[model samples]
Target: MTPTITTFTQQRVTVADGVALNVAVGGAGSPVVLLHGFPQTHLMWRHVATDLAADHTVICPDLRGYGDSDKPAATDGRTYAKRTMAADVVALARALGHDRFALAGHDRGALVAVRAGLDHPGAVTHLAALDVLPTLDMWEVMHGTSAAVGFHLYLMAQPPGLPERMIGASADAFFGHFLDGWATDPDAIPADVRAAYLKASREAVPSIVADYRASATVDVEDDQADRLAGHRLRMPVTVLQQDWGTALGFDAAARWRAWAPNLVHNTVSCGHFMAEEDPGEVVKALRGLLSR
Candidate 1:
């Protein structure tokens, strides 16, 4: 059986018309919503959420297109856009009685958190993004051979049909590849959690592809618009990432500084799954961000 965060209560919360999210909420005091990344579910925050729940009302939801959440068909370019996902997050928070809350996301969810911070600044009191750059900066930095590391991004960004079929063919191997390759510590995600991730990704191929495809198209357009309008994250921001910049030939902090003015950027010595690999560090960074 799949494990859940201790003491958290699970519920289905409607966040949009005809869409509801499977959410695990716990704790009291000020609210803090945690979003999980690609190939994972709210379960990714099992460690970090439990730690934060000691003092904060922790909200962990499987993004609309992942895990047990409702997966609407990608009818248009806007369907899986980070903008839509961000809105869902805001609505989720509002429904849970938080007019304002701290927010944190990992990987793909970080993209949504950044969009939320930009689109709904007043709703997000503080923001923390883990292991990702904004969509625009991500495309700008990846070039030539180095871009090969992100081949999956290009693959999922294709015009829908083919990408879905290809990934769906061997979903476990495809999704499991990242789980195995990105973690510095192989055991950070134990057998049960790894199995759960593979299971969820295996079942949500079309929506997952739609999510990534949106990043390549509409998501980038939204980021471009935000950049041109001189919009930056107004809330106190914290960014934790590996030293990908040194390998990719860009200044990671400088890249983040462009989008978030009040930022505390730290280079962590961990894999992509830092929250699981180093939950203490992730919790510490989030606590510091909230305190700001």
Candidate 2:
């Protein structure tokens, strides 16, 4: 029962640096690339992509180090950095003949989308981040008891060997923890799709931890530098997030305002897996972004 979106063609597009991304292209109008988050593949967008395909050329790609994409060894934590992942998708889009495209991502993919907007302003026309804050703002807000809610972030942020070994030892438990905890309804992700995620993540332990490790170190530095230089996402940006800020005692919208000046930020009723739990809302928000 692996979910399938009909009328989509899948292919491997070798990016500029020789990383071949497994991409799914469908629909027939303006291009819009969708990036999947951790513990999932482009399959997470099954519902939304099929719906958007009516009016948009939906491009769904498994982000590097996740799903079927190339998982290069981490060299000084640079391999899995958002900047590097962002470049992969941008190159993928351009190689597919999309010079400029609407971009939407959930979780880790959202981080990449944010970086793509910041790094390649000319290429990403509209930016939508589903269920995440900027890297700097994220680290800044996770404190005290509230920080416990993001325990995995802290765990994966540790030095590479231990985190990789720990997660590898209980790969299913590790990946399944997020799958179970983050969803408002466990059934939002069908059992077959859940199995696919667990299988892919189990095989990608080292690279997966590397992605989070880079987030804590290099990603933070990059975001801090951007803030100091007053660099914000120049394109119209929409953020759909659960109200973790309220539960964690911070103003999420205000925080996003600093990074996205032309921003439309709102809280979603669904938990972290907004795309699966509430695809229609995600679609509406993305449509709003496209209109902007």
Candidate 3:
């Protein structure tokens, strides 16, 4: 089905120094920022954003170099570090007149959301992370065969020019693989949505690769340092993940408890794309977290 271009509040944000991001806003009241996952855009929150917007202002932004945002050049030592990217969200919310907000992110966005809660404990009143572990734990849990599940982790983690060049060669297929592999139900992601995801990802290949590259290098180290220092998530936190007991090895929520103190974890019966496959469940889980 084609998107009818419904009633969405849209704008662009020049956040964190000067990076511009395309943002969609709606609803009114307390603010809640929805951050989409990798290989997807802010549109991923179509099901949940408007509902939350009814009770709280909802802000959705295409991260730095993704979606219709500016594709700025990645300077040496200034690539897409999660910390820097996380700052963009804070700035995005501020750009929309929100100094504090509830924040929820899915998959890659979950990583960013976790970082935001850690980096800006005061600004984020409540936190929700969907379908991901902390970056440090993600890398630490990797083993022989377990590593195979995320080939792109190594691929995109490659040094500088290599990953970008190879990914560019077949950008469509590269992004499509994750789009296809992650969703348990195709209807969960309609065709137009799929097309938008593929289109946004294809155009943002270089920055997307840079984002992943930073995650493997700087992002992982940063999360590790925070963990070593025993800095847990201070805000109310909700984590939604696949049980992963049979597929990945351990319980997903159990691993997350190591980092989040005020935490509630729900193992949903869905694939990694939990938000897309079951947005209502995601919304319910988030409401529960925010209420606490």
Candidate 4:
């Protein structure tokens, strides 16, 4: 069966201090920004964006260094910090004439969403993070061989040049591995989407590695700052995670509660790509979170 996609065109918008980005905007009413995870683009949210667009304006963008967006050379200051990425979302929302918006992000996008909420608590109305814990917790919990689930976190967190070179060598294999491993069903991610993700990741290897490196370095600093300042998410927060805690032996909800004072967290019976693996359930969770 040929699927029909609500064809949206590309529009370039500048953010991250003049780093131009390609964004896909559609629908009307209250604005909701959907951020896609690593090794993928805004296309990851194609199904959810269309469904939410029925009643609320949906703005999905190929985040900087991915998809149709500008792939700037990430340097000392211009690297892919979630803080900078979150700021890009702020600039994107403001450009779209939304002073306050609801945000939902999956996988790596969820990392950025949490940063956005903590940084711009006034601008983000509600926040939902799918399938990830905060960077600090994620790093601290990994040890010896037990942390094999996030092998890339340590690999990409290395000195910038090595990860970029290695990943670039076989970008297709690296990106395709996640698409294949995370999804419960092979058909969940169509071949075209898989191809697009691989192409984008290959093109954005430097920035992607920089993003992960930041997670291990500057991102950790930012999270530590928030922790020291006792900064908690002011907006209502929701977290939908696979039962990694049960599998890995950590209280997922308890960890989230430590950071978010106002929180509703749940574990879903799905794999890592919760949205793609279980779109209907993801939508229901979003509807409930946003409704609150």
The Cα error of candidate 2 at residue 93, in Å, is: 0.4
Query: Which candidate number maximizes lDDT?
Result: 1
Instruction: Give TM-scores for every candidate, taking all chains together and pairing residue i with residue i.
Output: 0.99, 0.97, 0.95, 0.95
> Measured by TM-score, how close is model 3 to the native structure?
0.95
- Model 4 lDDT-worst window of ten: 1-10
Task: State the weakest 10-residue window (summed lDDT) of model 2.
Answer: 1-10
Each candidate's number of clashing pairs is 0, 0, 0, 0
Candidate 2 RMSD to the real structure: 1.4
Task: State the lDDT of candidate 2 residue by residue for 1-292, as single tens digits.
Answer: 2234567888889974657888888999999999999889899999899999999999999888887888888877778889999999899998999999999999999999999999999999999999888899999988998789788899999986888888999999989999998898898998888999999889889888999999999999999999999998999999998888888889999998988899999988888988899999999999999999
RMSD of 1: 0.9
- Model 2 spans with C-alpha error above 4 angstroms: 1-4
Q: What is the lDDT of residue 149 in candidate 3?
A: 86
On residues 52-138, what C-alpha lDDT tens digit does candidate 3 reach at each position? 777888888888878887777778545688888889899888888989999999888888888898999889999999888888888
Comparison by lDDT, 1 against 3, better one: 1
Better of 1 and 2 by TM-score: 1
